[model samples]
Target: MQQLPSNSISLFCFFCMLLSSSYAKPRISSPAFAANSCNFPAIFNFGDSNSDTGGISAALYPINWPYGQTYFHMPAGRFSDGRLIIDFIAESFGLPYLSAYLDSVGTNFSHGANFATGGSTIRVPDRILPTNEGFGFSPFYLDIQLSQFMLFKSRSQMIRQRGGIYASLMPQEEYFSQALYTFDIGQNDFTADLFADMPIEKIYASVPDVINSFAYNVKSIYNSGGRSFWIHNTGPLGCYAFVFLYSPSAPALKDSAGCVKPYNELAQYFNLKLKEAVVQLRKAFPSAAFTYVDVYSIKYSLFKEPEKYGTSSVSHTTYGMEEVRINTTLH
Candidate 1:
């Protein structure tokens, strides 16, 4: 149960406050408005496993625990022991946890839908794996996720036009347009390159193209009438168990933070370019309110002070990769 930092929590709260003020009108109000002072109608998320609720489950079932042991008491397709940061954000806004877009049965998506998938990348890489089986390219890359979102919007619009249950809740346009749009991707893109043994320089060089694709997707969503965005930068990849297990550097090259210096540097480089691209995106969409969340700093704090965050060991927060490796090998 890795928790978001207090500062990150406050940041999200501040965003909610801003959203409340921006959407509030003097003329009309409803019971839902009275029930929750800051009633954001919906939330839409795009990301990798960091925010994936159940995309993996819908595609591949019987994923074993301790995946969702903390919260749901059963595997719920999230990569962690409990809820993701996005789940908490949704709860703070008085919205239900978003259902995975691919989840078919018993899913309530009136509030919003999640298009994130495990192992999704920002862009499909040019190089395929060198394995004899010719495997390991992410099928649900950001572009395809955006396309799925477009389809979701279309279907929701059709349902609204047909006077369905969703039409009573909110207009499809408003649902898509007013909902908070969030992006928490790009980690897998770097990880993919790293796993493929691409040169470090070549991996660094891919940042611009990755950010460009991300920015383009943002603009596309803006064109579709989205006006608010919360973008999370990549966290400290070097601190994760996967990095320690598979990509360890020399002890001398480790940072004071206990993370491999080179891997953290790569993450920082990506975050830097991402922030710059977001600045340009703000210029491109004058009406959109873009909030860049510093997830790297927040997550690094957990690594720095695991005890303070209610974890006896840092291993509790980041054993996903280790679990995956063990499970895959066992199967």
Candidate 2:
């Protein structure tokens, strides 16, 4: 696939990096933590903005201020005010931050690269914006991201063999098999379908296909030497003000949390299928470790009881990445 113009691919990646330092605290006493305590040489992430370091920013335009201010003290290309979940995961593993695959200026790929972009989806959509305009859905969808990874894998090695100053930036090939492969995409697929006026039944019908596509990609990555997979289930779409407010529904249709009930139900359905997919992946890739994290439950809790989490807002509607505290018991 041809690369879209940088401006065309630019999009606003959302999601607040609200967890505290305790989220990254090591739990040595937990058997799961102890069993998986080995060092990961690198992290190769695939997703939308939820885990994007700067793929969309580098591909499209720079992420402006207020973003990265809380942590990097500058616009760091992340949608969050501070470090993202990917950053904390890197910190936990003692690995350097994963650079965006598309970033060209001053990038070091010795550790790993992020192949995620804002507005990305697991399944490629039927309609996308014209090449000259910003995309409604990212051109670098999951399949495209995988293709880029394959290309990067081979090209980085080729560049290393040439033995130039650039070679030092490439990862040693063995890192591919040992790196943690993280995913936080698929949310956009549902949102896109919803916004397109696709029938609720039709959207439900598409879930299997979406899950199958995700499985296929994971299998392909496994074939390419990836063994550790950390897949995040999609969050509650209804709780977000963007969805609930824009949706043509009465206030009565909302649940007790003031979120559109149907959207969250759809998200729950998607998560169920996703968990089933992970189970099958575990069975198929016996040697690989597939950890399916339920970020939906964690995110929904905030919306369900904002006061409980010390946040005044029930939804993440504003473009500014606000800080909201969350429990640190994430396994």
Candidate 3:
């Protein structure tokens, strides 16, 4: 064979190196926490305003006030006073603040993406706004989040160049599955429609459908080779402002300590069923690393001992939105 030019050979080698680097796995950042050692390349957060960075802080919509005031000093689109647990988790991953999936497309997929939204629930029809107007985050489901993650992966060398268009949706036994997927949702369905005075039998009738929908969401990700997952249990709903504001009978339903027991009790039942589902999922997909993130206990602690966690002022609603102050007997 004829000898090739030295410059030509060098160019070919450089091209090959570039190609290899482009197809590498997504990168996760390290957290500053002393104890947390989680290394997630990207965090796919799917849930409500608690973990919402800006899902409710949109400019066009008539959103809530003081929702994220404490943290950003002026509603930086969060539904809390400060950084959420998911935000802290992302930091532990050594990543910058994860953006809402509704944001831009020029972001770096190599760093992972967030798919959380405010007022979002696992149910397809999230819930009716208090106006009885309509559902919020319509057509936005857990599947939408998975689809966005797939898009993020495709834009990166993680799958696009190597596997093909539907690579993320396909099995990845030959590759390292490092993406950290979290599903922290399902509170809206209860608060918006399934609450007491709404007919327990109606809720009972819909429970199976909701469970099946959630299972389908998990299975979709599973089929797409999502091996690492964190499913958050539903937070206590009885203590939330949604029920506190709308229903005057709420305080009457509370147990000692002024915490609503029946509402919390129902939440507990839903959470238990979710936990059981996760257990069955683990058995079905032994290769997957699945863990439950406890939102019930976390929210409970914050509610029961707001002084302990400094979140007593976390309560707010349309009626007493401003009147609601962050006060504690201990505080």
Kindly indicate the candidate among 2 and 3 with the higher TM-score: 2
202-295 per-residue lDDT for model 2 (tens digits): 9999899999999999999999989878788887787665564345663556888877788789988998898888888877877887777778
Residues 1-331, model 3: lDDT tens digits = 3343554333322332333345331111111111112344555667766566654444224345565555566656565556676777666556667677665433333445566766566776544233344334434556666676667544554554577554443323322255667777776666656433776556646666677778888877778766677677777777666566666678788875466787777777787777778778877877775666565776676667666764454454432111122222223
The 10 consecutive residues of candidate 1 with the worst lDDT sum are 26-35
Best-performing candidate as measured by TM-score? 2
User: What is residue 211's positional error in candidate 1, in angstroms?
Assistant: 0.5
C-alpha positional error of residue 144 in candidate 3 after TM-score superposition, expressed in Å: 3.0
lDDT of 1 by residue, 102-140 (tens): 888667778888998776778885533322443343467
For model 2, the local distance difference test gives: 0.73
lDDT of each: 0.70, 0.73, 0.57
- lDDT of prediction 1: 0.70
Model 3: lDDT of residue 69:
59
Specify the poorest-scoring 10-residue window by lDDT in model 2: 25-34
Of candidates 3 and 2, the better by lDDT: 2
TM-scores for every candidate against the unseen true structure? 0.81, 0.82, 0.72
